[model samples]
Target chain A: MPDTTTQPLVRVIAAKKDYPLGHRIVQALRGVTLDIASHSFVVMQGPSGSGKTTLLNLIGGIDQPTAGSVFVAGQDTSKLGDSELSRFRAQRLGFVFQNFNLIPVLSAAENIEYPLRLNKVPAPEARARALAMLASMGLSEEAHQRPAELSGGQCQRVAVGRALVTRPDLVIADEPTANLDSATGAKIIELMREMRDRLGTTFLISTHDPQVAALAERMLMMRDGLLCDA
Target chain B: MTSWSLAFRNVWRNTRRSSATMIAIALSCAGLMLFGGYIYWAHLAAEIHTVVLSGHLQVFKSGFKAKGSGNPAAYALANYDEIKKLLLADPVLGPKIDLVTGQLMVNGIITSAEQQTSSTFAGVGAFPDEIERVIYWNPYGLTEARQIPANKHLFARKPELDAADPEGITIGEGLARLLEVSGDSRASLELTALTPAGGLPNMLSATVRQTSIRAMEEIDNHLVVMPITMANDLVFPGEPMHVTAVQLLLKHTEDLHTVEQRIDELAREHQLDIEHRSGWDLNPNHERSLNMLDMFFAFSFCIVGVVLVFTIYNTMMMSIVERTREIGAMRTMGVTRHGIVTMFLQESVVLGLFGGLAGVVTGLVAAWCINHSMILYTPPYFNVKAKLELMCLHSPMIIVGSFFSSFTVAMIGAYIPARHASRMEIAEALRH
Candidate 1:
């Protein structure tokens, strides 16, 4: 496909994260290493506490590991301070979740524009971008509706629109289809895959759903916080 | 796209919680403001009393205030014409003096034909024309001068007093009531006081000409206003001299500060003893009222602070817990701990702003309603009657202070929650 070889957008190396659970330390991740190609649709699958979500978090730079390094777009996430990392997240990353965490008070259009606003994007431009994203997601008529007014599928659709509206370098989706029914779940995966194919936007999703795994071009299976198969 | 928009959204998300918090803040501020306004009004009223009744600066004999006894006419300025001419000629002090009048405080027993009130009265013999100039200082002068509604008619100019009749007196309505007399018609009243001549005590009989009201009932009820000539005749008999203190009224009361200093300098230059007293100093109750108000304001501020902290704390705690997964997702999406903190803080400030704005409107309206409706105030040690006052209407400080306090309290309340939000671990947060 059109000379699709490019530098990796995310690089994880020997990442380790430990959490204190009462008396014993729980190792959430243990020395996992991998490189995600630019614009690749990657899926990570594991049971609860298997570090699939942890891997996603490390890649996203939301949490720092006890030991290890994560680089997104060649910038080491561990080296950035809290504020800088936040700016990096706003400027370069987007996220989607199974719960479709749309702010309850904001309408669809406002939800999509939230990140842009946080990044201090000019109001008119942010509005135009949000409206365009809403229309693209078949939510043009529902722009003013809040999350409570939308159905599961519509909320998820709006969530996806919000995640991609900023046109970030990477999109992190953690069990995005877990809350939806099979049919609605499939539609969400289809929409995500469409975005990957059309916009060349890279996606890294953590899930145990076979339906979601089937749609990923690159599948990563994890066991006990370690990568078992790729 | 600004952080404020997000904060605004958060504010609207929990309407009940926000409204409760807002009301608490607004009511506290409004209460403080209204009470503060009352104290201010009382203080102002007292000041008007002092300035209008007593004058800003009084020129007296060297030891007149301390030892002149009740006969201030004893220390009457000898070079009266020269001093008046000098004062009237000074460019700096001339225009600043709104009204320059002379007052002669004398002790006399007011007696009416049918009723004999053998109580001590201070005969405030004043120059009719010049006294009106100085009368600018007294707001309740005419009102308290006479309590009987019908006696209000007596404040009108009396031809007898203006004609330099030696027997003309304008007694307080309370004094008139005490003397068992009325202000409208002429009546013979016996004025008995020691004459300043040779420090001998003398008695004179004067006709009741006019009357006035004053808040200080004692001063009004016993006051006998005789012509300077007549007062001089009865006290200093046949002496071409009169005046206890040279009263100086100012155009603007606030200009007292400037004029007070200038007058002191003038008094020093003329080798005269002129003591300056502000309206506040003369009314001890005004100072006490101000102190009590300040204490109330401080107490209210503390209450507002506590309420704000709790309010923001509750909201942020709930938000942090409810959005655990979202926060985790956001963190994974490259949002840092600081970003999380800022996001939550922004939400708090927004909440504060919205609530504060609502509170300002509510407070102003409530204050207006309360003021217009007429609250009853029955201060002790006085007549048993409810007084009506619009405490908040005329004072601008209360309005502005209340507004700023709300916003500040909101910001203060957001601080801890925002810090806690920033400290969350993305991995742990997501798991929850």
Candidate 2:
């Protein structure tokens, strides 16, 4: 088995992200520091307005911190330009979403191959990687079908396949099972954990669901933009 | 496998929007292409007409254009051969020349043998072969009329100065009608001109060989062309041949301004008192017609732009409204604000390309159909009837220009929606 106590791949140093919500200045992240170690599944759990998704975004380098730093695998993403951050994301980060944001026009297989294309990966390699990822999701048969042609659970499977196809160091999932039924959600959680076990990759999730929170190796509980419990 | 494929596929997802936008683009492209094609054809046609009627440039005696009628014989090129050699010997201008012919204008009276009526006409003296080359006066020239033997017979006879052949002379179609003259195989007319010899005006007579009408109504109604050798014998008598004007054909029609400037310098240097006129200067009405065509094209382009903006804007707004949650999901999935911008821009480009292609097909088909249907038209200013001619050129420029325009319009329409999508908070998006 892989060592579960490996060094952290992502380190947040008192990160702060604020927004102007009408006349009030909303603090999405308030000097919150966190570490997401390699080969560990981490969950950020909170109710609405808890900044769980904002924390995930900061660590993934999709959004910059207002006052502090988000470092991924030793690189401070806050210092990178827009194009550089995108390249970094393509190389090191994978993302899965609650609504399974598979591009509706593309086939399930194409959705999985999108990031690979953006990275200008060779076609043969991209195709092989997409096929293997689809097989792992048990969606190889529906590879050519569009997202609209698939059910909610099937669409999420494609989204997961998409996230994993890049084979990135970190996977950030924002309520990946929020759109599925209980049984489908459970199966999805199992699939994620199974991938983690096989690949020895880190998974970070932001969710309010108790079931998802329970499956994490560690959970960070947030309330009103502050880390209440770890 | 390519980014292009991704962009293309996204455009078709909303079929209604895609088709609507595409149709809009296609209509705009077709409008521009067809109108542009017509303008191109008109410009070419006008250029040909100018060359056929007036040659490339005309040289007149210093006072001939101002007051030639008072003493027509006095204002003439005394050394015709020297001027002709100067025009034909220039290295750059020689190869482009077809003729350096001379013409002498005079007031004349015509009377057909078949009738007793007589009408005034304008007589033009020219070199038969050279004038034929410049005017291309054969029946095979432009229109689809059967080859007439009149120009051929005129070419063969090479009529010279002869007072006895008064029954043989060429009259303009309109002038022939006014004089009631028949250009029948056996029939002919009489022509008499008032020429000057030794500074004294004298009467001269010649025969009308054939009747003809080119595009110029004024020239056709009154022109009476005769050989330069014959015209000189009648007008100058014992003296040398004198030409009122020297018509020059340049190597390239587009080089008229340069040649005119050169001619001006040469005239000044050589102490030759003369004035040079380009073909366009002699035809102001043709220039006005071309300007009107340009205005029509400009108006059509404005219409196309307005239609395209509205079409693309409607499609993009609908797409943004439909894909609200999807945009949010992409944000949470680590798609940055710029990525969202790129994605939307890519979609717009795809739509523009596809729409432009469809528009090209649609426009070309409409234009081809219109062209083939023999759509005869008489514009407000023109007296002659002409068929609508659309020559699309099928060049890389038209295709690329049309496609770019369509794509740009789509981008403009999508700008606001894409901006709105990019601004969606990841937290708010994930909640939905």
Candidate 3:
């Protein structure tokens, strides 16, 4: 038996995914197995349509595997229903998107406070924690600005703040810097490293940017829907 | 931020689109309210006209309505005073009754001496003060009082009839015209009729005091108003007074059925074989008109509902399509499908509340403006032109119904799109 005391935070065993395209089934993920330890910063590098986003979606509980199983925080996500998966995502996982998907209507601080509010945190405490998170991102002066009012780097920081505000056990980022300039991309990558180090949260990122890949503690390469050894 | 606050802000994202949808809802609500208010006012006006033309309930001898038309005096109630006293003393009915009076009918020919013109006439004899109360003292006051045309004011004003003018009579304007009697001229006319017992012709003379415009165009050509005592003396000289029927006016028409029941019980106790008829029973044409008006109101309401539903549905569907990515993001941030639906519904509710409230306010203001305006038009079967008035604020049900219907329909419109949004696959939604 494997050691339970030092068991990985995420365990994927021979996971596979297939999507129906019109009249045919397209394989998005081939049989893949991986283990990510706690507090590890891992990056999966791939070109377009190489199944990196699909893998990130499976790990984040946004999609279920067509076969095999995915275990996150000791719960088998493949067996969970849609509603249970949603709750699991809320309590144990967070996501950062390529386009910095901060709710356009909410202020920067309010967007960060949203997940905490969903978790039933008291209003004042949620507000204070959102402010603290914003300050930590060096965005205290832009707390009251909406996504439309902020620059791309500022918006990405707010998105990062929102993902980490709930202190989830795992954070998944899909092409986080694809929409940003090189300078902004480097800064966002630096912020994510600092956050992972300080909060001891596991980070799983899918990217084609070498600057992002250079910061990964465990780097995996994917091509043709299969992960190859580094 | 709270879901409600988020929803509130989201609605304003597309200012022009949201405002247009809200305006559609507001207009629908106001249109329904105004049409409903007009129908209500028409109902009240028609009811009052019927009651004043014929009292709320009329008591007749057992066979009067069916058999008395051919020989009215023979089927007339002989103990008229006794029946009036019994009606006035009824414990359950007395307080509800506003006025009770006896009437006598005289069918005769009127001859204008100076003009040398003769015409057939149907005449009613009533108590002067009681007729005044029935015609003028409506519960709705000035709004109802204005329903009586200027030419008919004599029926509701001074000198409708009096002892000093025991022989004074009011005739319809068409009848006066047939007799060649103008408003400026004073004239005397001779009435000839057949007595009940002798079947012999009898004649009496009366001074033409006033001319009125009653409801029906045909009635206006042959109607005469006189005193009951004069009618009795002309029909049965020196005999005890007799009347065709006793008419009752009530404080409220809603109590007609209850009052009719009590009157029937009283008639039974007194051992009188009598039948009672309500205003609606006597005025079938008025009731038919009211039914058509009710149909018009229902048709208008359905139209408003359909248009409003489609408007709100289109608005919400477009909004959902535009925010597809944002919805996916929220789902990714741990908002449940139910949460997404709730947020959209909350936005719809806010729209409905604001739109419905604006509609009610606009409807009330429009009603006031119409009531105060001098818009006039002649209605079918009416002898005089009537004022156009809408009674919106007086009807609480219409106001509440308008708001509730708009709000409910708006929610229904939002629900379809919200459900669609909630069931969307996150991956496809993100791609959108």
Computed on alpha carbons, the lDDT of every model, listed in order, comes to 0.73, 0.73, 0.85
Tens digit of per-residue lDDT, candidate 2, span B1-432: 665676677688878778877777777777777777677667766776677677888888888767885556678778888888887787656676767888776665766656787787777677665676676532222321112222333222333223444334555666766877655443555555556644444445545555665535676677666666656765677778788889987656777887888778778878888887788887777788999888987787777777777777777777776777777655544566787777777888877777778877876788789877766655444334556677665445655666676667767877777777777765565555
Candidate 1 per-residue C-alpha lDDT over A1-230 given as tens digits, one digit per residue, 9 for 90 to 100: 11224547888889998888999999989889888998899999988889887788888877788898888888898898777888888888888887787877778998898788767888898999999999988999999999999999999999998889888889999899999999999999999999988888899998878999998899998889898886
Q: What is the C-alpha lDDT profile of model 3 across B1-432, one tens digit per residue?
A: 778888889889999998888888888888888888888888888888888778899999999889876667777888988898888888888899988898888888899989999999988878876667765545764354345355344332345577677888888878988999854355889998778887987899988887765657788799888898888888888888888989999988999999999988887787898998998898888899989989988888787788888888899899999999888888888889999899899999989988899989988888789888867777788767677777788779889988888889899889988999999888778778
Alpha carbon deviation, residue A174, candidate 2 (Å) = 1.7
Q: Among all windows of ten consecutive residues in candidate 2 chain B, which has the lowest summed lDDT?
A: B138-147
iRMSD, model 3, in Å: 0.9
Error of 1 at A62 (Å): 0.9
TM-score of 2: 0.82
Q: Is candidate 1 or candidate 2 better by DockQ?
A: 1
Interface RMSD of each: 2.7, 3.0, 0.9
Whose lDDT is greatest here? 3
Better of 2 and 3 by DockQ: 3
Candidate rank order under lDDT = 3, 2, 1
TM-score of 1: 0.85
**Whole-structure CA lDDT of model 3:** 0.85
Write one digit per residue (lDDT tens) for candidate 1, span B1-432. Answer: 455666676666777876776676666556656666666666665566566567776667777767775567667766656666767778877887676667677776666655755567877777866665555444433223223343335454444256555566677766877777777767777777787666676777777776665445556666677777667777777777777777777776777787767767877898765554554554556467667766876886787678767877877788778777777666654566677777887776666666666666776677678756645544432232234443565657666766677667766777787777667776677668
